[model samples]
Target: MIKNIIILFIAFLSVTDLFSQEKPFWNDIQKFKESDRFNPPVQKAIVFIGSSSFAMWHDVQDYFPGYTIINRSFGGSTLPDVTGYLNDIVFPYHPKQVVIYCGDNDLANSDTITANEVLQRFKLLFQKIRKQLPSISIVYVSIKPSPSRKHLMTKAAQANIMIQKYLKTQKNTSFVDVYHKMLNKNGSIRSDIFLQDELHMNAKGYAIWKQAILPYLKK
Candidate 1:
């Protein structure tokens, strides 16, 4: 009976693994598709794609009045998540410009993921975007220094540096440094910019981001 039970347990594990492979984190993408069905967004819009930071930006349109904007950010997602849903969230819109705020979640989501690994993921997204869009301008927003995720700041800083340096090498790519601006004079994270969760940014934080990002937008 014990041997039979072990075989059954192994079978259960196999079934679970198969289920996981068949179904990815796709519910959010489905909702976006549904929303688009009823209220289709304009094509060639500026798309802000990333994790919770962009997801929580409720007043993002207010920040930039003259520009056409679309926020396709999904909170609790890493770089792979964004790339995974490229067909649904990214390419469908035919974005004129793509602004990204990821990598922080990549490090915070998994302890084993190295900064260089995060850099590689970003590079993949970069290459894919350039290949697919060709003439589309891209912007990489540096990861913010948050009080809650201070422990992962080292990796975050490294990922930012790597991505920033790489953007310098590519044309029509810009790196907005919200990281340095989010730091206090003593080099600590400025807590006032974040909400009580100490992870997502508040309105004041978005204000600072607006100042940093506006100049880089295509005039």
Candidate 2:
């Protein structure tokens, strides 16, 4: 009986540990929830949702001073991850507009992941958002040409084009073309805009983004 009790206790411990394990970006989401509880964000603000590009833009609010911006981007997140947490980051805010800057990670995630697959994933998220908030304006920032991900550039461009074409068909949607703006006259990616790691951007890159995205903001 003593041995059986010990085994049962060990099994219980194992299950508890399993349940306690947090997935990627789970902590980030929890932090956002905690912040919201302490000091809630104003509803109907522009909610920027996506991966590290938007995540690293910590001063996004300053870029567009007049606009009420609530950025909920978590580092290294993909379209699927954002879609998964839409309830927590998006709908809860009742955002007047959602500006998405993702899909770069999706292409870089795996060679097997095609441009079409990325488009499909994006479409899934868009559909879910439209179903929930029909009148809300949606904006997609084109995947920028990162010096580190040069190999994936062509694929990323393809994905961006596909997304832009799709967004054109949808009502209240805008596609910001930062990809072309970030390129040089020679068509090579301007390396000066990237940080030391080359994956993320510097202030110069964000400035270019501001110019392209400013026109599309709802107010």
Candidate 2 Cα RMSD (Å) = 3.9
Where's the lowest-lDDT run of ten residues in candidate 2? 16-25
Candidate 1 lDDT for residue 200: 87
Off by over 4 Å in 1: 1-24
lDDT of 1 by residue, 1-111 (tens): 999999999999898778656756566676788999999999988999999899889789999999988899888888888888787788989998999988888898788
Model 2 spans with C-alpha error above 4 angstroms: 1-22
Clashing pairs in 2: none
Residues 1-219, candidate 2, lDDT per residue (tens digit)?
A: 999999999999888567547566777888899999999999999999999999999999999999999999999999999999999899999999999999999988898999899999999999999999999999999988999999998999999999999999999999999999999999999999999999898999999999999999999
lDDT of each: 0.88, 0.94
Total residue pair clashes for candidate 2: 0
RMSD for each of the candidates: 6.8, 3.9
